[model samples]
Target: MKLKRCFDLVAGLIGLCLLAPLMLLIACWVKFDSPGPALFVQQRVGRHGVPFAIFKFRTMAHDGTAGNVPRMWPAPCITRAGHWLRRTKLDELPQLANVVLGQMSLVGPRPELARYVACYPPAVREKVLSVAPGITDWGSIKYRDEGSLLAAAADPERTYIEDILPVKLAFYQRYVDQRSFWMDLRIIASTVSTLWR
Candidate 1:
């Protein structure tokens, strides 16, 4: 909607301005913490199933690979500072830029990696990809400690595909079906409160 778009633009701009110093500090910390670029760009499935690069402050070591890899949560690939960034969700700050660029929305379904997107059935993909991908969503708030959850699994990827992803997809489809400006605001407020708590 027009109001939602305006809200995204205004809030995103304000967030960027207010978080500028923090973002800079994070960039410097990431650089010193690891021998790789401060920012990480990964291809994600966005609106209409389009592929776009999602940006975040690098929260893993340079050699890290996407998705579940064997038994570990790939924890070893995360640098010390990266752990803090990921834990505090500061790594997601860069996505405000993505929202500003119209590559994403303030709230909707979280973007999926191309590999995961490939597993989405055609009908489900059509429903989920109907709107712009978001930085946070119901699934995100509910599964805030997803890394730990995955770590507990005997086969993380299989558990994700069979269980976690289906639940997330249900929430995603619900959001798509009933999304409104006020709903977005509520989601944002809920996210902030959840994070604070």
Candidate 2:
């Protein structure tokens, strides 16, 4: 656990350093492309069910309705730049700050919104939240295109809550049960490969 935290701290700092210039460019692009701030911050359930502000590069229009999980298929609120940002997953880059702050890990179960956490089965919630939520995990890898999947569903929110959430929870549990430094590395490598491919 100590080693993992140290690794997360070091990796997060290094990532921020290496990615800062690109993040600035993306932030400028987001600002020029849309009317809102470059970063989006939302509360997510973290370790031990604590709520923390998770940051991401803003990928939606300036409308007040930008924060929640996608409720609409073909989400009409996405901005022109948002389309590409979300597609490339560049929208998640700001979360390195969260990782640096000790609020998140580089790899683990992805955090969920409070509403979604409330729906987690008690044992599952306990097991999953036993560790810090991560920037990427098996669930994230598998559902990388979750918004697109929901876009194709008849009732996107319902499908997310009923179908996708359960699968994600199972993945989260598995991650917690089998967690290790090596596992985290594998997950990170997989995420990079997945993104590149």
Candidate 3:
């Protein structure tokens, strides 16, 4: 997947350059609208069960998430600006750094919190973690409304583990089985379309 890495490096660098201004604006909005750093740093499981600190815009209030849970979490802790950032997916822009650093791919299984990854069955986990995790993937587009769906559940954590996660895992398996440059391109295109809608 050296070619994929090359694409990720170039695209990530270019993306950061192009989105710098908008990222700056969002950073300001987060600062003014809340009392924390604009960047949210969290440990997620990368390829082969390795942990890495991935970055996203702060879409929750300071001290909102003392711990990560494996569930949809558009909680009351979301600030006004944070809500918008999450809605528009602008919060994920900083992940270009992760892409450039080779911690992630542009199109592959979305990285999961270690807490969530811990829940994966042994064989399933091995297979899923065999490749680099991604910022967007087939599972991501299908589960684009995950936060909202989780918000509506009677038990968000339970629902995610029992329902949402399995579905996402199935898609992950398909993506792994069928992956290629063209498939990656399609996944990226689908991701953009999902965001636009």
Best by TM-score: 2
Collision pairs in model 1: none
Model 3 regions lying over 4 Å from their true place: 64-71
Q: In order, what is each prediction's RMSD in angstroms?
A: 2.2, 1.4, 1.4
In candidate 2, the residue pairs with backbone N, CA or C atoms under 3 Å apart (3 or more residues apart, or in different chains) clash, namely none
- Weakest 10 consecutive residues, lDDT, candidate 2? 65-74
Clashing pairs in 3: none
Model 2, backbone clash pairs (residues 3+ apart or across chains), number:
0
Preferred candidate (TM-score higher): 2 or 3: 2
Give the distance in Å from residue 21's predicted Cα in candidate 2 to where it truly belongs: 0.6
Query: Which lDDT tens digits does candidate 2 get at residues 75-146?
Result: 787878888888889988999999999999999888888988889999998999999999999999999899
lDDT per residue as tens, model 1, 1-197? 78877888899999999999999999999999889889988888899988888888887777655422321256677789877887778889999999999989989999987788888889999999999999899998998888778878898888888989999999999999999988998899999999888
- Which has the higher TM-score value, candidate number 1 or candidate number 3? 3
TM-score ranking of the models: 2, 3, 1
- Model 3, 1-197: lDDT tens digits are 88899999999999999999999999999999989888888889999989999898887777756346332474887789977887888888999999999999898888998777888989889999999999899888877778898889998988988998899999888888899989999888988988987
